[model samples]
Target: MRSGTDVAYDDVNELIATATRLMQKDAAPDTLTPDDVRKIGEELDIPARYVDQALEALARRREEQAREAQVQERHARLRRVRLRRSAWVGAAVLGLLAVSGLVVRNGLTSTLSDVARQRAQVRNVVERRESLRARQDTLTPGLSRDAELSGADNRVAIEQRRYDERAADYNASAASFPTGWVVRLTGLPHVLPLSSEVSTW
Candidate 1:
């Protein structure tokens, strides 16, 4: 029977007053009844039907809230699964890198060792040649021209030349191979050792 605007303003005032009283008491929504809504509507000059509509709207809002909470729970579970998978993948990658590093380190150490051994053999050959030359010089005046020491000196020189050739070949092969490929391919256990290790000639 009242004007729409007057009814609306009165309804708003009544709703505000009820809300303030409920807040002071910390009243739960379950305690709110249709009779309480109807009483507020009557005081506001509002129709009883509108009060029922407001209660239905509140119920729909509660249902929407429940659906949103369920969605958030599913999203949190999916995030946890993705994080665990990423952690495992990261660990596997780190392990592979560590194993590769060890293989490369061992290969370099072995190659350097072989080179050291070859150098030592070359030094031995040189020392033997020098010793033979000294003996030949000491015996030149006392022994005949066709002395056994002269023949021994020739054999020592030949041995020295053979060692020299091997050293030269080793140096050449090392030069031909690039450092990157050497590390990558030679890191494997089955791959043959450097060229110098297998051949004497």
Candidate 2:
């Protein structure tokens, strides 16, 4: 809103100050046409050629600003697309890695379980042989034959052989490539191919 056009000002400076403050809030930000530029130049004693050069420079600046905005928009669109695809691809890769990790973990667990079982069998056979030998030793060899003791010795040997084979397999797996990493991560027990300690009865 304007103070009435008919209002009197104390001086030109006062009028200019009021107009400046009003323009700060009330300007429409419209661009000047060629006619407006010429009229302004004529009033301000500016040359027509200078006005033409100013218009040409303004046009070039506007073109540059428009191009910069387009480039920025294109980059933004590319980033959005990459982010969207990365979400899907990342999820799929993670799913595959999870499945693979589980498989390796289960495999190691199963092999170690077998090694533990076979170790128990070997121990049981050795204990049984020792007990039979003790019983046979208590009885005079002349009275009872070596049949039970022989059988116990054979069983102990067979079970020991089986346990050795199972331990060997476990050791091989633990030393293998990706499964080795899995074993390390899962804290799986390490098994040697065979034990050197001997039990004799």
Candidate maximizing lDDT = 2
Alpha-carbon shift of residue 4 in model 1 (angstroms): 53
User: Tens digits of per-residue lDDT for model 1 on 102-137?
Assistant: 665565555556555665665566566567667667
Q: Put down candidate 2 lDDT per residue, 24-94, tens digits, no spaces.
A: 75775456679799889989999989999998998999999999999999999999999999999999998
> lDDT of all predictions, in order shown?
0.64, 0.81
The whole-model C-alpha lDDT of candidate 1 against the native structure comes to 0.64
Give the clashing residue pairs of candidate 2, or none.
none
| Ten residues in sequence with the least summed lDDT for candidate 2 | 192-201
Deviation from native of the Cα of residue 140 in model 1, angstroms = 5.0
Highest-TM-score candidate: 2
| TM-score for each model | 0.51, 0.69
